[model samples]
Target chain A: MADKVLIYSRFPKTMMTRFAEAFELLDTAGKPAHEVFPAEELAGVRAVLTAGGTPLGGAEMDRFPKLGAIVCYGTGYDGVDLKAAAARNIAVGHSPGANAASVADIAMTLMLAATRRILVADQYVRSGDWAASRQSPMMRPQAGMPSRRIGVYGMGEIGRKIAARCAAFESEVGYFSRSRHDLPYQYFPTLEAMADWCSVLMVAVRASAETNHVVNADILKRVGADGFIVNISRGSVIDEAALVAALTDGTIAGAGLDVYAREPHVPDALTALPNVVLSPHIGGHTLDSHVAMQNCVLANLTALFDGKPLPHDVRPEGKTA
Target chain B: MADKVLIYSRFPKTMMTRFAEAFELLDTAGKPAHEVFPAEELAGVRAVLTAGGTPLGGAEMDRFPKLGAIVCYGTGYDGVDLKAAAARNIAVGHSPGANAASVADIAMTLMLAATRRILVADQYVRSGDWAASRQSPMMRPQAGMPSRRIGVYGMGEIGRKIAARCAAFESEVGYFSRSRHDLPYQYFPTLEAMADWCSVLMVAVRASAETNHVVNADILKRVGADGFIVNISRGSVIDEAALVAALTDGTIAGAGLDVYAREPHVPDALTALPNVVLSPHIGGHTLDSHVAMQNCVLANLTALFDGKPLPHDVRPEGKTA
Candidate 1:
């Protein structure tokens, strides 16, 4: 018997059909993706594929009696309740290394935007105020600073990629991670050390119970008034309130944020700051990444039907790899 | 006797004093710097210090009889007449590496702004038409495309730096120069070949008599409708007419430009296009670069006085080492 796959989010019709052509697809259409999971839609579904807005929780897993697995379409699995899925003996898998390059590209994009003041300069040019702005004593530095030190909070694929780009600018790169890896640059013993060493800090770690609020008030203070921050990882990685306070008081230079604590609904404080550059949580929403991620889903589905080990299974709290 | 250095362009008091402290400075305070040479102000001047703006053509050089060397406070030496300097045995020097990193940083900035549709998105967001504008069909793939091939047109200092940063995105890099070097990536024989291999192309080559309009109508057309172009080197390297035509017809994807055919002035054709990102020719304008270039000027002064080989001498065709 064919493995039945249920797509739980709104996706491109062409791509959905590409997956459906290979599986016994169970249709679940026009259901507001982010609305709480419908009980009726879970009836007899063997597996579900979802991402971002369509979060799958504990109670929803209980509805599917014969559900063997859940596949997240992207890297971040925060929306999916991994612990609950584990308790139900349901496998949870994600598309790791799928959008690694895409996320890395955006991370560098944000870093460059923050460092070079692209938005400010572009605004000056568009407003027909380039000449006036140049003459205006109000303008600080139109060009980016040279020879800055860059600090990376995570040493994963995306973080390392950002580090590589930073190093190309001849910036000294120092990183903080759980375990030390052999890198071209030095590794700091702690995030505080990393923060103290750099005027530009980039946070690219995972968001979990163990890592939430890793960049807090104390760390923000350590970054100081001369430093800038860029959060491309998760909104929870940074203490948003602390960020707001620091930004308002001019305790930190500026920030470029791709994610937020409450995304698609940013705080008024952040949006009001002239120094900050904010984007909706669409960093990984590139055509290249979407296609790559969907292909990963195909591989995971193929493996499940073949009774083989899934490629990127998220183990339970203490389960063996 | 202390070597007398003439200060031409106006600078901050502190910066002027700082330069003076390094050498015996001639303060052309009341009189216009241009009038100084033919007038009594040229009496004891041994060296001249000027920014990139001061015109030091053949006629101007005829008046500075005792001038042994000139230190350009910026990278480009367009205002200096090469033939006149060579004829009179007056060494002409410029700051090269001083601005490489700065230019590379802003080059990448324009690339990101153009590629990610930042300017357009900003306009869309601020107009309160976010919903309508975003929902409108765009030719762009998405926020950022990943794993696509990237091409660099001159593999010199700034170009190589841009390439190194591009590598961080896991972009397969291909480059075109007069001759291939032993770089980490493949080398394309021509610009057309490079464009054929890449979805994004960056023009970081020199602009000169031979290289003028190298990226003309044919090359732009060859790059195709799905490719993007970034020019940070010199505006003359690209055919402005061809670029305008391409952008108008959508023969190429998009463009990010720093230099222009007529600078301090931009063409309405480019500004009118929603797909282009434009910046004034300030790619190498940074505090660090300014200081570094000043130091290069000092080096040129020292070398000329001590009868040593001047570093970074501008050639007949304007290439520097």
Candidate 2:
């Protein structure tokens, strides 16, 4: 019999095909663990696989006495009760930087789509507004990328990639991070200062208690009426209500979002707006990213099964929750 | 008093505001020259301003016997009868490379949007499909930009900018231009070879008789079903029927087009497809680009009125017709 692993969060069956081949997966399909498996079955579970944003706490860990590892599917592990896992002597592992390139690619996609008014232009051609020589407010010539200010909120892997791409387009790149790094981009003392200086604010900060709702109304005001905000990081970083109001009242020009405060439940107010470009939370959903993350997960899981330390362990500093 | 200048094409009044201040304009508003202005107005017109895509043949020049200078408003002079101007002892001037950066920006926007399926994702979010956790083919993981082959079909101003932008995204860049330059990108001898080698074909070639329909069925076949094409060059450079068929039959995965073979009259078959991202021919339409082009236009006209050589004269080789 194969070693069993519990699926702690909902994921598509296709994504689990390779994992299924390697182990007997106790798939709960996002249901309560007790409802899906007997206590004996749970007791035999030595490792659990989970999505990064699913809530997993010490209470859940205590239910499985044999539990030795918690593995995150992607770069983030914010929802894992890291402190509790550490206290329980369980090794936590995540695929760091596996999805950074894809996330950065989506950031540029959202920025360009929103800034170019591409959707509006598409409708113009499709609706015959362009053919009829109609005048639209959006048809007014937009400012090009040259000399446009792009401010990144973090200096992590994704933020660095975004800054590099923006710089290639001849945009001026700047950043506000917790600590200054040796990157080529200009550094700002605070997020407020960067927001005030940049035309486009790219939110790539990691999710933490301090970062929750950090980009509130005040930051939006600092971004100004002519500026744009693009968030590819956790939606919790932005106060959703404040962002909607800012977009409605023109406190900011527009927004491009991939993540929301709640997954799979975007507010109708946001979907109804013309000035926003919205996507489902899929910033890291590329094929290459998935493969890379799977390799890391495999490495971590193989280590645990062999009674060894996780080679891809989540750093101690990452144990926020 | 401002010098009399004939406006041979229709343009938005706002776009002409600055020029109106510099010239006494006899606006044809895209009507026949003879119908809009009398013989006296035509005879008095020494300089005519025109959009680069509007057809201006020698027959039209005969209508304005005293017309000494034909100034194109944008970078291209493909539609101007350059040989006729040369034969008539008339100077042709254009704003060369004024809109390269803006055009290149839109090129990247279209490439990223179409390749990433931004429109499909947008619809999935708006229709509550994402909220319902529905499966979409478009939601399947896509390839990231790293090491992806980007083949630019021309190495002109816009092409160079596109290559630079793609390089910043960490893609493998290549080109098939008329002549080789000292750029770091790989050079393919022909479009067919590049089409086979690259995953994304960026159409940035100059429009000419020799280049018309150069990217036909065979070229698109080499691009394969997983590939994409982005055209920012003139509409006549592509074979429209073949492109539509290829898109429908999955000969190629998708296309992002800013120009069409027929400008205002796109076929319904082409517009109804879900795989293409369409835009009006607004590649060079940006405030900064226009300002730069207008300054060139201002210089060309100023030199013409002063009986000096047009400072921005069209080179003899651009006389396509």
Candidate 3:
């Protein structure tokens, strides 16, 4: 008998199908693979390979009597019940550092778009008012440059990359991290301080319980009316209600967000603000990034099937059981 | 009697009024300064300072019997007919090198805004479609770093500044010029070649008969569907008709224009496109740029008042007239 594998991601099936031909592949895309055990369908399964959305808990693990390992197919393993897997003596492997560059690129794009008012210009041209309104006083304000101070709320790989990019434009790059590093730029002691100092604040931190609501009403107010905020890390990083209120009340200049509090669901307040630039959670969805992440998944999948210790394993703990 | 000065630029009167505390200022923002020489407002004038739109043409120069100097209160001298002024021994001074940094800043802002689809996402948020389309496919396209080729059409001060900003994003920068100089990036032999090589092109060349229609249909076609064009220099630098056709046919992806072939007039075809981004030719209009340009005008005015030779003069002849 061949080793069984499960996949749960928005990857091209052709790539996975080719890999499956070489092994006992059980794909779960449109429908859960019957041969592979989904949490609810877990029965006599030896191992599992899943995405961020599939929640594997203690209840499901009980069904897989002989399960030894679970492989997360992406960089984040937020949905996995790691503690339950650890208690059952099952190892969990995950891919890391694969989509950092792509995520960084998205962050910069959002920042540039929001700061420069690209969409506003588009409307001006498309509405047939550009020529007649060219000399209008309303047109005069469009002729300016980006703000001086730039703030990054996270000092992770993506945040660091964005900082380096901002430096190229001669923008004063400042960052808020767990512990300040000796970077070429300034490092604020706290996120609120960073917001206070910078005119453009970008959130590149992760989405976790401890880090939730890091950018709330108080922080947004500190950012002030002349400032801008961008969140590329996670939707939970910012309180959406506070952000909308700030934008509505002119507490801050504008915002650029790639992720929201809920996936595939955006709040009406954020959607109603002309100042905010919002993109679906796509900070890590570039072609280059997708290919990189998929390759990492393949590497881990190949390692697990060979019955050897995985290169990137998550010691399951403190997850929803 | 105090020397008479005619102000032709539509600047905020408050600023001019403050500066005029030292001079016999004749305000002509809305109406002609003097009805006696309506056509030649500079007639019997010691110095003349005109804004961005007022063109001092050949026929008008013949009437300025007492005009000692003409001062362009902005960097672009296209509005002033230098050769005509020179023929009559009238010195014309312009504010060159004044707005280089500001113009460069706006050019980069436009590039970043267009490439990242910033404005489009903003509309998405403002239209109350966030929840239904939070994870829409359009939003996902900009999730990571953009790895696209960028081209600069001019290699002057503004062009170089744009190049510096482009390199900051790790974008491959290439350029075209009348005569290529040594630079870190690649230099294409022709505009078509540059277009072929880049997914985004910035037109930063001066608008002269030589540069008119430089970006024709062939160049647009070379730019292809994946490419975009940005013009921060002059409108005539691009062939507007060809551009309209290219956009309509999808020969190029889109454009971000700050200048139009006709001042204060945009073409219907160009205006109808949703992809295009337009601003009312305010690329070099900034607070810093205005101060620098005004200082240049002041220099020319002072030179005329003192009967000294004018600096930054534009003599239209191949040689100084």
Candidate 4:
């Protein structure tokens, strides 16, 4: 019999068909694998294909006695129980740096839309207000991007790309990272210092327990009344409640958000506020990025089935191969 | 007596106050001088402060026998009867290059919004469709900026700036202009060829009789089904009927328009389309650009009143100082 592999997430049909050629693929997407598959059905499963959202834990792994590898389709495998997998001697693999360009594009898109009042402008035209008033009330005379300071909270691949695009618009780019990379952008050791120095604060850090709520009320206050904040990273990287309060009280000028603390459940407070631009969490969810991620997953699974080291191994300490 | 100047358009209160410091200001912003001013009241008018929308024709010029100069507040004096002014020995001045940066910024904003389906995404989140569907239908897997060809219809200051920004996004920039400019971007002498070569065609040419309807059905068809068009220049530069037809018939993929053939009157057909992003003619109406334009207008008026040559003299043959 062909080697059995459990598919824990939905992939493109073409990719799934390609995988099916080499293994007996069992799909359990959008439902618990334990609930979807009986013990006997999962007994021969030696590999699993998953995503950042549908992670495999010890309980799920214990059901599959022959499981040897867990390959995640995209970056950020935070949902996976890495310690549990490590103790069980199961290898973990995930795609990294696969969606940086799309995320950076969305980051800049949010910034420009929020700063330029695109949503308001579109409404002004659509509502026939422009014809009646003969002027755009959406014009905030002080709003512009040129020569403004843009503070990035992280200087990883996505952050660096965002900074590069901002530079082309004549913005002064600065950043706060754990350790200074050899980048030409001005470096700040603390988020507060960067917020104080910038007119636009961009949150682009990876989400984790240590980085959770990095942009709290203090950072918002430092960003101040004329400042704008944009978050394209994971929602956990920012304190959403504090951000909403700051926006409500005018601690900051405005915001552009692509992620929320409880996604698809944006607070009524944020939805009711006119000073924020809200989007569903779609920063890295582009067709090109999806294809890259699928390719990475296939490569990892292929390498594992051949008894070779996984191409993008993830460890318990948050390190990637 | 301070030389009397007739204000034909509404300027910012601050700008008008500054002009008041130098001249005996007569405000007729929304009304005709004939309706607002009696014959006696118009007798001493030695200059006219107008916008492109308010033309100074022979009849208006005859009313003010002492009129020596027509100072326009912004660029695009196509509406002003330059021959009539020149024949009467009345010099013409306008603010040139004042709003280039702002217009360039908006051009990029529209491009990103249309290509990335920002307006639709915003609507998706706002209408709770994202929450219900849990995924965006706006994701076109092949959509991106990297390695794409951006064909600029004009190589003016704003066009060059737009190209610079597109370059930072890794787009290949090309242009179609009447004559070659001293730039590194590929130049096509014909619009049809450029449209064929580009995935995104940008309209940035100035409005004039010869340039009217430059981007018609032929060019749109050449751009094909996978292409997008962005216009930040005058609405007359395009054939609106052909564009609407093409957009309706799917001859082109999408469009981002900031200007319309008729001011304040967008066709229901254009507004009803889903693949286009529409905005009012506020591309260069930012506060920074307004201030710059006002400053330029003031400098030009001051020079004309001081008996010095106009700083930005717009002649009948489309030449400027």
Candidate 1 accuracy as lDDT: 0.74
Pairs that collide in candidate 1 are: none
TM-score, cand. 4 vs. native: 0.93
**Candidate 1 clash figure, as a count:** 0
B41-92 per-residue lDDT for model 4 (tens digits) = 8988988888775546788889998888888877777667877887888888
lDDT of 2 by residue, A1-321 (tens): 357899999988999998888888999999989899999899999899998888898999998899999999988888998889989999889899999989999999999889888989888888888788888998778778885799999989999999999999999999999999998889999999999999999999999888999999999999999889999999999999999999999999999999999988999999999888998988888888889999998888889998998877886554444
Worst 10 residues of 4 chain A by lDDT: A134-143
Full-model lDDT for every candidate: 0.74, 0.90, 0.72, 0.82
Instruction: Tell me the interface RMSD of every candidate, in Å.
Output: 3.1, 1.1, 3.6, 1.8
lDDT of 3 by residue, A17-133 (tens): 555765565556534444444554345455677765456787766767777777776566666787888899887877676777767766776666566565565566556666554
Please compute DockQ, using alpha carbons, for every candidate against the native two-chain complex.
Answer: 0.44, 0.80, 0.43, 0.59
Give one digit per residue, the lDDT tens place, for model 1 in B144-261.
Answer: 5445678899988888888887776567888999998999988999888887778788888866567788888988888888778888887778889899999889998788888877
Error of 3 at B137 (Å): 7.3
- Point to the candidate with the largest TM-score: 2
Regions of candidate 3 where Cα sits further than 4 Å from its true position: A1-75, A79-97, A134-147, A309-321, B1-5, B9-42, B51-55, B124-130, B133-146, B306-321
Ranking by lDDT: 2, 4, 1, 3
Instruction: Identify the superior model by TM-score, candidate 1 or candidate 2.
Output: 2
- For A205-246, candidate 4 gives per-residue lDDT tens digits of 877768889899999999999889999887888889999999
Best to worst by TM-score, what's the order? Answer: 2, 4, 1, 3
Q: Give me the TM-scores for chain A across all models, comma-separated.
A: 0.88, 0.97, 0.86, 0.91
